[model samples]
Target: MITEEYLMQKLSRTMSEKLLRHARGVADTAEKLAKKYGTDPFKARIAGLLHDIARDFDDNEMLQRAKKYNLTVSEYGFAMPLLLHGPVAAVMAREDYGINDQEILNAIALHTVGSEYMSQLDKIIFVADKIEPNRKHAGVEGIRRQANVNLEAALLSCFDESIRYVLKMGFLLHPTSVKARNSLLVDQGSFRK
Candidate 1:
């Protein structure tokens, strides 16, 4: 039940200009992807705009807020509380913005690490977050192109990109991400399960 004007007002007042810019970019990207994928563009935009509502919070704050929001954090989330931002913000979108749409909320929640079973809307937001104009990385343009053509292809690319980055950075690859990528691979019948 949130309007674009209201969402922008809340985000701008609390978030840094940098985060706001990223949010806007994600919103635009999500909307475009949603339209292309036959999902609701308004819902996608709302989810995208609020996806990172808690991204800037400090690590401890993320942990605390995760509990306050009643999100059960995994060991991975406890170790890397940044992962909790998505879920925390999903709750914020519900409690603060009065958004009761589970689909939009799930898209926001899983945008960080991804889930094994993702809807088209979830795939759209995840891909949009990575391919948004504000994002910069190796092969992002190619991934963006893939997103416009195929959501699952774009999702696989995004997952591969994330895995590569995590390996390069020596970070533990979250299991959810692994399962998500594997789910797609299995569905394609290309990987031995």
Candidate 2:
């Protein structure tokens, strides 16, 4: 397990502070969700902390890192710059940061453009990222409320919102996001509201 101090040291000063605070917020949210759903708090915290490790990087740098780490960048990622960060972050988290845990890496990789086989930690980070305290959106408060009530329901809401937002912006939806929604729908019986 990488120490928090070591993780902070690896980040740039500005990114370190911002990511640390965000990580803490995600951790808090993750812990709450984990407790509610009977998942592991420690795993949730690690997933939350590392989810955005590549968020601060620019498009060119992100692609470079992705290539360096031999991450299989999807066509969607190539067309849409925003989607590249998560998978790139996963690779960097493993190769650069020496975090070899597959579950943690998968959580980071799929947090943005989620996948079909998302683990519990993946769901925790995905929902936590959307509902973290600093996030302000039209229905974020409602989503957070739903998260408190039911984690699966919260994820359904979040995934629906994410897809709608992406389509509204005239961007191509990553297939992984669709797969995630389908998987969740199978688990939760479709998104509501």
Highest lDDT: which candidate? 1
**Clash-forming residue pairs, model 2:** none
lDDT of each: 0.92, 0.81
Candidate 2's TM-score? 0.89
Whole-model alpha-carbon lDDT for candidate 2? 0.81
Best by TM-score: 1
- Give residue 36's lDDT in candidate 2 (0 to 100): 80
Estimate the TM-score of every prediction.
0.97, 0.89
lDDT of 1 by residue, 1-193 (tens): 4699998988889899999999999999999999998999999999989999999999999999988877899999988899888899999989988889999999999999999999999999999999999888999999998988878989999999999999999987899999999999988787864
Stretches of candidate 2 exceeding 4 Å from the true structure: 12-19, 190-193
